[model samples]
Target: MKKNKLEVIPLIDDFSQWLAEADKSDNTIKTYRAVLNQFHEWLLSEGMDLNHLKKKDVQQYITYLESQNKSLATVEKAFATISMFARFLKKLDVVQDIKRKQKDKKNQEAPDSLTLDECNHLLAEVKKRRQPS
Candidate 1:
């Protein structure tokens, strides 16, 4: 009888293993997995290999996220997920650390503010709570 050879496993398999061992919340794990799958799909669409990914590739993904009208916080979360995945790959000796570009502030608009009276009332309440008799 001939012995059968096992086929090479995918990077995602390793990622799933690591995610299982990680001490993270269920929501966090789900979000990370979703972001990773998005990255995997983007890689497939672009004919790119996981081991050969570059910072520019990450930038392109960021641009794609922006084009889809994703909020800055959501984009940041996706970037953080990718960064974590990269670290996992590094630990597995699959690839070196690839530095992603800092996000551009062009899409970040200032948040709306409360009225002066509302701010003053909030501050007064805080002061009252902190004051010693």
Candidate 2:
């Protein structure tokens, strides 16, 4: 049978209480709430209700985030918020530990492709620039 989606509304009270008890700043808690709300809305549109949240669902959301071209930092913050919320929901045994892998830096090129000769050439250029005329 298909699982149900997790309901964000029912979690608000306990989530807020947990955040407050943790001594999280008001802005931090507010950020968490915003992230969760966004995920919750996505859940609804994806035919999920909030009761059947799983790690895969979280992965899908991350994938969706990547597809949207959100920066790695943005995605990381979202994952952190989800984890915090999931930790709270876990106390109630309603949600799984929904942590995800950090997003890759899309703009940074991998260094493995550069040959040793290419590296030496680049280093020479840097050294040449460092030497004053």
Give per-candidate clash totals. 0, 7
lDDT of 1 by residue, 12-96 (tens): 5677678778877778777887777777677657766455667767777877887888887878887888778778867423223
RMSD of 1: 8.1
For each candidate in turn, the TM-score is: 0.59, 0.63
Cα lDDT of model 2 by residue, 1-133, tens digit: 3223444576765787799999999998888888888888887788774556677778788879878989878888877877777777673233355444554578576656789999899999999999989
Global CA lDDT computed for model 1: 0.69
Point out where model 2 deviates above 4 Å. Answer: 1-7, 91-133
lDDT score, candidate 2: 0.74
Deviation in Å, model 2, residue 34 alpha carbon? 0.5
Clashing pairs in 1: none
Model 2 Cα RMSD, 1 decimal: 6.6
